[model samples]
Target: MSFRTALVLLTLLCALIWWQATRPVGAPATPSRSGITTSAASSRCPMPPRTERGAMPLQTDVPAGMSLQAIGETNLRPLAGFSIEARVLGREDYRIGHEADISPIDLALGWGRMTEDAVISQLDIRQSSRWYRYSWKDTPPIPVEEIVRSSANMHMIPADDAVAAALRRIERGQRVRVDGWLVEANTNNGWRWRSSLTREDSGGGACELVYVCSITRE
Candidate 1:
């Protein structure tokens, strides 16, 4: 094309970009790197004045009629009804392995004293390879057993696309109530993964495998 024609097209493109850049919250949300469009521009997430000090996670018996649920070629069996209101200490996203095929995210959640900044600031918490780990500089802030009892790494299988989007937006330090089922996943190929039945244990096989229905940010 002619130089004048190209110049006019470039000007229009620049103007369009500028308009979208400064657009109001009502404007359409752009897609994330993963191609999921978020409503964060229209949604307000206010920071709480203080960390919510909530009780431990609540677990109950699996309700009647609960059975095998299919996800990504895997069948999930409800082991127990599980719910937790805790501070999000850390988050990890996965895109590989059988676990990622179903549960793509894991949250390092902390409750009780673990939720307090006074306690958290004294520790170094991290998550990877579907596990959560923590350490301290000199003396430990809390007993290792109490820390084990109060915090965990939870694999999250979002129940729907909306829940998946919400899970992606979760940030560190947000106190959120995650309501769902503790599940054991099995495949016809004989692959199996189960949720831990107790929070009083630590190390391998202690993480909870959750089928998340809803997450309420507090």
Candidate 2:
């Protein structure tokens, strides 16, 4: 063949070979209507099914709320910036086991006493201008002489409506004892710990507000 013809033929052959080698193989005759569709993927390994629910999810980082009915003689440490005292009210079916999940009490009780041997409402304590008297007339006010002169002592500040009601009981001089978590008393943050407390006393059931106070036990 002539040199010019031979060179032309060789170029054509190379182009054809390159085109053929780059062509797709085993692909659908036509492009998929959905475009580049991919197959559903399976996980690399099988996962086990979830087993069960754990114990009640109350915060382990903070003290759990208790009720007056459950009060017993146990040594308790004074919470920083807070104080704790106990008085004998009565016995209660405190759920030492799965009581919360099973027979949950209508409310918690027995953390404080109105007197040396009485359980009073936590609400009453906060309400008593004599014992509490923090805010009045929209701004802080000096307590009257009777409150300052009275032997009544201070109790945990209510963190929520429930706690407020409990304190109110003490304010009214109703005998009450309540168990609760001790926390920094912030009016803004108190809602998280307030609880509606109920107790069967004086042959009748009563309901009131209680605050959850923090406690530490070994």
Candidate 3:
């Protein structure tokens, strides 16, 4: 080829070689809308895994202010549609301090139900000095001990002989059913939840007894 033609040919070859060398190895990727790389894009729009919540089981701790029907059916199962019975299990007194005289006011207790509210109420009002018995321990157990004190506000209305005796039964481990209302109260401690039921189906009287009731499922 003539010098001029040869030069032109050489120039074309150089241009082709340079273009091939500068070409991208893989896909000439485009920027995402956010201008981040593909790896970053994958992370930004990552997939979320699946999750689930299991079936709710029956509970015994009656939520504070829950109705009697609600307590029996949900928290206290095996009691569906059955009227809850509250018996004044018994009266119990506990000594607060190491010495009898130094101890705080005696704690009367009656426990027939299984919620924080009921237990607190039972201990506050229905429970009396007589119902409390000392379990065998290293020595005579302290009365009104911290462990036995329940924080419930209960009314001390006069109860009939049968009703009073029923309270004793509860202290002795007898289980009695009660019919009443649900009240909610919050205190210095955490949530105090329970169910309260006065004895109904009898004549209209002041049978304002309380109980602490809870539920457990097998």
Candidate 4:
């Protein structure tokens, strides 16, 4: 190849790499899952009441092959045993400080008829460490208050490596069932982290700190 041609090609390659690295990530495509109905009428279904305490014991049938265990208090206080079957709205991974050693998966989960609504697709949802954020161009399908209460940003502390790996593999828009306990962690220096049992509130201290014992995709 001619020397001038080679120089031009190298410059183009550099530009391409730069563009690829600097480009923003576009919004994810709308998801379509079997048995999930995403119609405007479905949004009219009543929203679940706001919870102020821990989740009740599993009354619904547990998925086959799933195991349950009593999580005794170790260093953290096990406030309540909890479980939920919801859709994975968003996920964020962290790698810093004590949290780096355990509890890396932070999931924004949605349940009820909201799981099938196009509102989720219309909104740009994202999670950064323990925080969740969303934005939309047009009017939201449901009330913003209902959406806040229906979904939550949970900090999942996996009970084992296998469960952690499973949580890591969860994708956006997939249905996930999580079984665990709500806990509050305290450090020797007096720093502490606790889970919020209520879904009606927002801002600081509203996130659930869960020690997940089992996780599965539906």
Task: Please report the candidate that would top lDDT against the real structure.
Answer: 1
lDDT for position 66 in model 4: 36
What digit string (tens of lDDT, one per residue) describes model 4 on residues 1-218?
99999999999999999999987442222223543321111111111222232342232222344332323332566666666778889988888867545567789998765586577778888888579988787788788888887788999876654566567778888876676667777666676788887768788999888777566565
Q: What stretches of model 1 exceed 4 Å from their correct place?
A: 1-53
Tell me the deviation in Å of residue 74 in model 3: 32
List the lowest-lDDT window of 10 residues for candidate 2.
38-47
Model 1: per-residue Cα lDDT over 100-173, one tens digit each: 98999999998889999999999999998998999999988999889999999999987766667778888899
Model 2 spans with C-alpha error above 4 angstroms: 1-152, 171-173, 184-218
Whichever of 1 and 4 has more lDDT, that candidate is 1
Total backbone collisions for each predicted model: 0, 44, 36, 0
The lDDT per prediction is 0.80, 0.28, 0.29, 0.67
lDDT of 4: 0.67
Q: 156 in model 2: Cα distance from truth in Å?
A: 2.9
| Models sorted by TM-score, best on top | 1, 4, 2, 3
Q: Once model 3 is optimally superposed onto the true structure by TM-score, how far is the C-alpha of residue 159 displaced, in angstroms?
A: 12
Candidate 2 lDDT, 132-198, residue by residue in tens: 2222343222223322222222223323333333333332222233333323222232322221121
User: What are the models' TM-scores?
Assistant: 0.75, 0.20, 0.19, 0.65
For 40-68, candidate 3 gives per-residue lDDT tens digits of: 11111111121112211111334343332
Say which prediction, candidate 1 or candidate 2, comes out ahead on TM-score. 1
Looking at model 2, residue 28 earns an lDDT score of 19
